[model samples]
Target: MTDAITLRESTPADIAFLQTLYPAAFPDEDLLPLVRSLLELPDVLSLLALARGVPAGHAVFTPGTVGGHAAPVALLGPVAVLPRHQCQGIGSTLIRGGRTRLEAAGTARLLVLGDPAYYGRHGFAATSDIRPPYDLPREWAPAWQSLSLGGDDAPMNGTLRVPGPWCNPALWA
Candidate 1:
């Protein structure tokens, strides 16, 4: 915790705010459709980081399964913070808060396709031996990371299956 950023579960009303926030944060990529679709997935955790009552950052964790295990797991991604709020600790706060909640709710591990450096600071590290069901671009091998979230520390050694909306081939590339 950062004292200024307030983290909370996003309400339906906050979707519009997130829609605007995503574009502002990622001007080149259109993440709005994915955000809208992920919101409908069961057991998805969508957290909002509000600075002074306005949305400053957002993160989402959704159900995912490893090919051979029943243990709970999640996929985290598309974490966004408004350009004006970037590097202000709002993104870190949202991630920490979401990780805590997910661990408490029994999530075993989390996987992400993101910058290794940024996610590594939050306890994520590159995983080998495990792979996504679809071929993630070869260059992204270093970016494919996983973290033990109150679960076994054993290497996650299987292909991953994420929610339908997240199955887009464009994302894997």
Candidate 2:
């Protein structure tokens, strides 16, 4: 049987765990630097999931804004789980935990650029109402999705304003 998974806010102390986690989770991509920089940014929420006291997965949420939405907004990304921990609900636990914290903090919406099939299971739906920081490829447009966090449901037809590190067009592509 698998060990119980525990969720907690990530601290600088977890960087070493992440150094190895991200590389293994995303072998072909170089997302380590981005993940490291995000952890040091103010207003960014990071979560760590541990299995039997060992780091098993992680998720990061960063504040962002849609041009017209008045309430707070956030972006969910760079989430990863160690290869061995792949389908044990750790990723879902991290996401739900993050959503709970953000909603408690008055966040209006949470956006993510990921597999539609996966995020859809978590209540995320494709959204054309709010645009991402940059134009996504036509095929990947469906990957841009959002979930309303019980704040304001008013239409937000504007581009997302992300932080400096997320401004890189290369990352958006």
* Cα lDDT computed for each candidate against the true fold: 0.86, 0.91
Prediction 2 TM-score vs. true: 0.96
Q: What are the runs in model 1 whose C-alpha is more than 4 Å off?
A: none
- lDDT tens string, model 1, 54-99? 7799999988888788888888888999888888899999889988
The TM-score obtained by model 1 is 0.95
User: Candidate 2 at residue 39, lDDT?
Assistant: 84
For the record, the alpha-carbon RMSD of candidate 1 to the native fold, in angstroms, is 1.4
Candidate 2 lDDT tens digits, 1-173: 24498899998888899999999999999899899889888999999999888889999999999996677899999899999999998999899999999999999999999999999999999999889998899999889999999656877778999897899999888
Error of 1 at 125 (Å): 0.8
Which ranges of candidate 2 are over 4 A from the true structure? 1-3
Poorest stretch of ten by lDDT in candidate 1:
128-137
